[model samples]
Target: MTHKIAILGASGYTGAELVRLIATHPEMEIVALAAERKAGMEMRDVFPHLRHLDLPTLVKIGEIDFSTVDLCFCALPHKTSQEVISALPADLKIVDLSADFRLRDPEAYETWYGNPHSAIEMQKEAVYGLTEFYRDQIKNARLVAGTGCNAATGQFALRPLIEADVIDLDEIIMDLKCGVSGAGRALKENLLHAELAEGYHAYAVGGTHRHLGEFDQEFSAIAGREVKIQFTPHLLPTNRGILATCYVKGDAQVIHKAFENAYADEPFIELLPLGQAPSTKHIRGSNFCHIGVVADRIEGRTIVVAALDNLTKGSSGQALQNANLMLGVEETTGLMLAPLFP
Candidate 1:
């Protein structure tokens, strides 16, 4: 069964990525493309890299007939996503890539996003789209909220340890480095080639980054208590990938065993051998996440490293994975491509 799909915000990086991946998907077909600003233009005109394929010309969100779309991937900006998704057909399944529906509490959403959620009722029903942890829920969900790239990477490193009680909760600290693509395709003075190249710097220091809300909500729920970890993210000069180095107090071997056990049956997650580490280069442009663990010289302290393309496993690839489940197709159908290596 070919599931008809529409991609809103078709001009953005994630939108183009969805097009690229779905173009090869066996059970999914892109039927419509929407971009408010790029309306009436072909997707290839906006992203020449996609010029090879034939796709519907971009249109305004309101112009598309959602009744015909089996599922929609909303890659729009946060506030915009809520308004657009709220107005979408009630029965239409959705996978939202924005931060709009990620936090369950409206107040928490306001506190982090600085705006009260405009679609509270819809937010309540949106399943968190962390596919590995919420597979069953995603399969049945009418709406799924994709996690922040950084949040997803961090959780992959720590969630298993937290669930197994193998790590010290209070001492957990994650220092992550992300490529500029995670910031989105929007233009920023800081993201310019001259300004960002040949350098790397940290932002959202001192627990100020918005993704902390997701980390707080998810980790707290898992541990059955308030779990706050020191999280600081750095902006790298590259165009893809995320490398998260996590520090936890635990036995290295035990933590390694815990991850191996948790992800043993999972397809996209790769747990490396003990004392080894993964690099962003290995998983670039792929829907795979590589995790590795190493013991610190100090007893009872361990280090965990995780890597993936911020735009793939971190966003579009994840959306497609969930869409597969929702459509009753194999979860790994379109996501089996190998990581691009140099």
Candidate 2:
């Protein structure tokens, strides 16, 4: 019952993470590794840390025989993934880690990503890959769209509140800080060590971030109305993790109870005790999300904070979780590795 897996765009951080996790999976085997830019090179050549394992040589996506791959993890860039995935066999189960099939509406996709979705039919069929909330859907889906790291962090803190109607919807605000690796492995002048270290600043202020689309869509769907929150994300100097502090007008105890009750059966979500707060360092390099809730100093207000590794639980790990459901394998397989702690 072993499932053959293929990882497209295997040279990036998230792709490498998939390799690291899949290497230990008992029921899954990596049969194809595709990295168009790094084609003909061994994965060990691109990532020396992986030099010890015998891995498939990196090839272009078009060169792989999809019929032999039971499932594929698409970790390519935003628009690039849609084009590559569209060409993949329709029967192949896929877990896409890019922004391609996340937004269901093609207009919303075009509005936020600035282009029409190339795979409209496939987009319509793809299920949202929020494991805890969409388990059944993911299990039967031909394609699952992995959420944005920032979006997933925010939702982990707020989804329960929205579903329970325990918060004032109009007053919801999320302030998030993310490590630089969430921006991707691509070289950017701003991401240089000298420029990013020692200073942290906010970008995508005033609802300008693309992940806001997910917050709006999911929140609105849950509440059965238009739900828009003020979302601001900051780029921190570190290499991993995302911390989202969500502000809401509600009872702190009630919010805590809601999260605790909602995540009681979830394996990867840990709801901290009341008045405690989560830190990014605690869940670094793990497929775990820690959430904490506290009463704000102001009356009728509460703060919910969530922490998770952007590359692991936030992306590739999530892709693997969804793929497990699709393939009828144990959801926690290969994902139970403990968080890296100092």
Decoy 2 TM-score against native: 0.99
Prediction RMSDs, each to the true structure: 0.6, 0.7
TM-score, candidate number 1:
0.99
lDDT of 1 by residue, 48-103 (tens): 99999999999998899888999999999988889989889999999999999999
Q: lDDT winner among the candidates?
A: 1
Candidate 1: list runs displaced more than 4 Å: none
Worst 10 residues of 1 by lDDT: 78-87
Please state the error at residue 213 of candidate 2 in Å: 0.6
Cα error, candidate 2, residue 326 (Å): 0.6
Across 242-286, the per-residue lDDT of candidate 2 in tens digits comes to 999999999999899999789999999999999999998899888
Model 2 alpha-carbon drift over 4 Å, by segment = none
